[model samples]
Target: MFIPFQPLRTSSLSKKAPTSVGRVVAITGGSGFIGGHLLDALIADDTVSRIYVMDIAPTTRWCEKVTFVYTNLARDVQFEPQQKIDVVYHLAAVSREPGFEWNEYFDINYEGTRRLLKWASKLDIKNIVFTSTGMVFKAGPFHRAPSEVPSADTAYGISKALAEEALSGWQQSKRGRHVAVVRPGAVFGRGCGGNFVNLHRALRLGTFAYIGGPDTVKSCIYVKDLVALMRGAAELKGWHVLHGTYPQAPTIGEICNAFCKVFGWTRVIPTVPLNLALRAAAPLQMLNELGFSNPVHKRRVEKLHYSTDIDGSGLLELNLAPTHSLVEAIQDWRDECAPADPH
Candidate 1:
C-alpha cells in the first residue's frame, strides 16, 4: 500500500551539473536551478543510462534526450519512476518563500517528503539523496561540526526533521535503501533563484544589506560543489548526514567586503536583526504565499540572524573539488552588474 500525500512536481536543477547519459536516476524538482544541473551532469556522464526529471515545470531545456514526468510529490499519484532508478535525488521543498500558512508548510515540506519516501520504498529504490538546509538547526551559536542529532523549530525545519526521522526509521528496518542527508549552508551562484538572488539584486543596484549582527557568519557552498556532494551521496550512503559547506564560512561583513572589493564600493549596510525581520516578514510572507507575485516576507529570512555552518570533511572525503572561489564568484557577480565592458 502506498500513501501519496502531496501531488505537486517541480524540476529543480543546478547550472554546472553534467548531463545524464548512461545511469538511470530519478530526481524530484529537476527543473529547479540546482536540480537542472543534476540532470545535466547525469546526462553528460556516459556511465549514466537514463535520467528521469519529475516535476511540474516542463523541461525547457533537454526535453528530447531525457524522460520528463509531470507529478507533484504533495499528492498520492501513481506514476512510475523512470526505469529502475538506482538513485533518487529528492530536492523539492516549500521554504523558498516566506510566511506560508502552517498547514501548507506541513503539507509541502513535511508530508511531501513522506510520500516521496513511501513511493521510493515501494519501488525498492537503492540509494536516496535528500537535499536539506541548514535551517534545521535551532537558534544557537554556529556549529563547527555536524552533530549526531538533528533539530528544527520552524515549519520548514520541522518538516525536514520529520522526513529525516521517517527515513531513519526506514533505515532501521534493515531495508536496502541507503539514505544520505546533505545540509547545505547559504547556497550561492549565478542563476540561483533563492536567498542569494536577493543579495544579487543588492549588488546589481547597490542596495544589498546584511542581516543580524556583524559577528553572524553564514556557511556557504558553491552550487557546483553541492552538485558534487549529491553525486557522491548517490554513489554511497549509510544513514549519513553531510554538510555541503566550504571549510571557511563568511560572516555578513566578510561577504559584504568581498562584494565591496569587487565593485570598488565603500560600504555595505547592516539589515535588521533576525527576530525583527521575521516579525516584519511574517505578515508580508503570508500575503505572498497567498500566491501574490512578489511578497516581501520571504520564508527564508526567518533565521537569517546567526551564522550557519556544517562540516565539509565528509564531502571532501568523496573527492569533490570546490567550484568557484569566493573571489571569483564575487567578481563575476560584480561584472554582471556593471555596464558591459565596451570591448
Candidate 2:
C-alpha cells in the first residue's frame, strides 16, 4: 500500500538536524543499499514531513512517511503535484564491477544525473546531496583533497566526474541553492553489497585466501558512518564537496588479521602473489566478458592490491568525523548478519 509521507516523533537524539523542520524530501535509488539506509534515517527524522522515493524497484520495508514514485532515470523522471520535493538526495546509479556495457555507465551515471537535475530544477527544488565515489582518483598511495581537480582513468570514474561537473554547473546557474557531492570509499555494512561484503563472507567461512602482500592500505567506511556524513552534508550550506572515508585507514593484512582474531581462528591464512593471481584469473575474466558470472575476475582481483588512500580532512572541517571503527563495524556486521553455520 502506498502511504503519504508523515513525520513521527522519536526519542533518539539527532546528531545533525534537531528536526527535519517539516521538509518534503525526495531520494532517487531509494530502494538501493545506501539509499535504503538514508531513507530509514529520513523516516526517523521528525523534521522531515514527507519523503518521495523515486526508483524503478519497490521497497518491502515501507513506512507511512515514504511514498515510492516509480522512475526510470535513464529515460525521464516525473512526479505528481502533491509530491513537490523540497530537497533531493540523488543516489541512483549503476555501481558494480564487471560486465557493464559502455553506454550503460553513461546512460545511468551521466544522463540519469542530468535528467534528474533538470527535472528537479523545473520543480524549483534546490537542496541536493549527490553521492559520488572516491574511485574518481588514481589508484595509489596518494590522499587527495576535494578541491583538487579529479583524474579518472576508468569509465565509472569518468561518468561520475562528469556528473559532478553537471551538478556544479547547475549550482552555478541557480542562486541560494547548495550542492553537496560526497565521494565515499568502500562502504560496508549489513545488507550492503560490494567487494567488502564478499571479503567478509569469505572470511566468515574461513575460505578467504590472501591475494597479495599485507602492506596494501585501503580507505573504507561503515555504511552507518557514511550515512551520518551524508546527513551532515544535507544540513550544511555552500558546496560541500568532500570525501567520505575513514580518518585513519587500516592495511589489508591488519584488517584480515582483525577478522581472524574476532572469529577466533588460529589458522595461518594462505597467500598468493598478486601477479600470479591476476595471470590465473585472466581466462576467467575473459569468460566473464562472454556473459559468464565468473567470480574471479582480473579487475576484481586487482582491487586486492590497489591502495585506495582517500583524504577525509575536508569532511572533518564540516565536523562529520567517522564514529565507528572498522573493527567494531565488521564485528557488528558479522554478529548481526552472518549466517549461523558457514562450514
Candidate 3:
C-alpha cells in the first residue's frame, strides 16, 4: 500500500533546528542484504529517532523504531513518508544477474532514482546517501579512482552511472543539498549470498580452481564496514563520491588460501589456464543459451581472470577505514555461521 505523504506537524520549535536532536531517517531498500545491516546500525544509534523503510518487499526485521512502507520504485507510484525525513538512503537497484533485460536495469536503477529525488525534493530533505557499484569503472590491474570517468560496459553499470549523474544534478540545483555516492566492490559478510558464498561453497566441495594465475586482484569490503561508511557519508555536507574497497586489495589466491586456513583444510586448489577454462566452459555457455540452467558460463569464467582492483583512499581520507582486515572479516563470517557453514 502506498503511504500518502504527510505534512510535518508544526511546533513552536524554530525551522533552523539542529540535527543534534534525534533525526528521522528513511531507506529506499531496507529489505535488501546491505540495507538490513544499515537498519540495525540506525536502531542502535542515539542520533536517529525514527526510521521509515520503503520497498516493494516487507522487511524481515521488526522494531519499535521502524515502520515498513510498501513502495515500488520500478512503477510510477506516489509515496511520501509519515515523518519528516532528515536523510534518505537510496540502496534499491537491480543487479546484473542472469536473464535481466537492459530496459529493466535502466527503468529500475536510473528512472527509479529520479522518482526518489522528486519525492525527496517535495519533502525538502537535504541529505542523500546512494549505494553505487565499483562496476562503473573498468576492471584492471591498476586501482580505479573515484573521479575517473565511468567505463561501464554492462546495463547495470550504465544505469548506476546515469543515476549518479541525476543525483549530481539534484545536488547542484539546491544550495544546502548534499549527496554522497559510495561505489563499493564485492561486499561479503554474515548475511551475504553473493560471490563470496559461492566461492566458499566451491572451496568446500573441492570444485574451486585458480583461473590464469594466483595474483588476480579481487577488490572487496566487509558489509559492516560498508554500512558504517554509508552512515558517515550521510553526515557530510557536499557532493562526494567514494570508492569502497580495501586499500590493500586481496588476490583471489590469497582469498582462497585464507578460506582454507580458516576452515583448517589443507587441500591444494589447482590452477587452470584461462584459454583452457574458456574452451571447457563454451559448451556450458551454449547449453545455457539453449535454456539449461547451469553454473558454468563463458562470462563467469572470463571474469575470474580479470583483476577488479579499486582505490579506496577516499574512505581513509574521511576517517572511515574498515575495522576488519580480509582474514578477520572471514573469521567473523565463520563465527556468524557457527555450526551451519555458509554453504
Candidate 4:
C-alpha cells in the first residue's frame, strides 16, 4: 500500500501566517510522490500564502490554501493564474516507466518545460525550482558530480537535459531571473513505489538477493530531504545546479541491512552472480510482457549491480544537510506505514 498524500502534521517550516504577508507559489505535478511532500512542507510554511497546483489529475488530499488547476503541461493549454505567482516549483516530467514511447518523454519532459518557461516569462515570475534527475549522467561504476558535463544515455535523461538547457536559456534571457536545477539521486520514502519498495517487497517474500556483490554503492536521498533541498535551492540567488543526495553514499548491502533491521527480520540475504541473475530474470521479463504480473524484471536486476555513487557535496556549500540517515529514513517510512491509532 502507498502512503497517503496528506498535509504534514509537523515540518521544518514555521507555522502558518496570515495571507497578507505570504508568498504565492505554484507547483506542477503537485499530486506526485515528491511533489506531495513538497506540498506538505509549503502548507506548513508560514511564509507561503497560497498554492496553485497545475496538473491533469487532482491531488488526493486538499486544503483551503491550495487550488488545483487542470493544466496539462504537454499540451498548449490556457493557464492564467488568478493571483500573481511569486515562485514556481517545476516537478512535472515523464519518467522511465514501462510502455512510454520516446515521443512521450520528449513531449512531456522537454517541450512541457519549454511551455512552462513561456508561461512564467509571461507572468514575470523570477524564481523557478526544477527537479532534474541524476540519470542525466551516464550510469556506471563512477561517482557523478553536479559540475561534470552531463552524458545522458537514456531517453528520459536526454529529455531532462534538454529541459535544463531550456531553463538555462530562460535564466540568461532576463536580469534578476533565477532558476535552481536540482538533480536528485534515487529518492525513496513512504509514497515511492519504486526501487526501494520493490526491494522491500522482494525481501518480505524471501526472494531478494544481492546482485553480483554486496558492496555496490546505491546513492540515494530521502523524499523529505530532497524537497527540503529544493526549497532551500529556491532561496539562493542566480542559477544553481545542485545534486540532491546524502553526504555518505550507502551501498546496496547497507540499504538491505537497514530495511531488515527496520522490519526486525533476521534471515540472511543471499548473493547471486550478475550474469546468472540476468539469465534468470530474462524469462520473467518475457512472462511480464505476455500479461503475467511477474515481480522480477531483467532491467531491475541489472540496475541492482550498477553503482550510482553520485557526489552531493553541493549541499554542504549551501548549508543544507539531510535530516535523516539511511537507517533513520527506513525506520521513519516503517512508522508511516503503521496502522493509524483508533480513539
Better candidate by lDDT, 1 or 3: 3
Candidates' lDDT values, in order? Answer: 0.69, 0.78, 0.84, 0.83
User: Model 2: runs farther than 4 Å from truth?
Assistant: 1-21, 81-83, 290-292, 338-343
TM-score of 3: 0.91
**For this target, which candidate reaches the highest lDDT against the unseen true structure?**
3
- The sequence of per-residue lDDT tens digits that candidate 4 reaches over residues 1-343 is 2234455344312354344667899889988888888988888888887888787777765676777777898776476766678889999888854447878988999999999998898889999999999888877888988778888877888999999999999999999999999988899886788788878887878888888888998889989889889899889899999888887788999888988888888767889999999998899899988999876787677778988887887788688768898889888877886763100
Off by over 4 Å in 3: 1-21
For model 2, residues 99-175, the per-residue Cα lDDT tens digits are 58777878999999999988988888879999999988877767677787888777788899999999999988879
Tell me the deviation in Å of residue 89 in model 2: 0.7
Evaluate model 1: give its lDDT: 0.69
| Residue-level lDDT for 262 in candidate 1 | 66
How do the candidates rank by lDDT, highest first? 3, 4, 2, 1
**For model 4, what is the C-alpha lDDT against the true structure?**
0.83
Per-residue lDDT over 199-257 for candidate 1, one digit per residue giving the tens place of the 0 to 100 score: 65566577655566666777787776788878987767578787877766777677767
Error of 2 at 182 (Å): 0.9
* Lowest-sum lDDT 10-residue window in model 2: 11-20
TM-score of each prediction: 0.80, 0.89, 0.91, 0.91
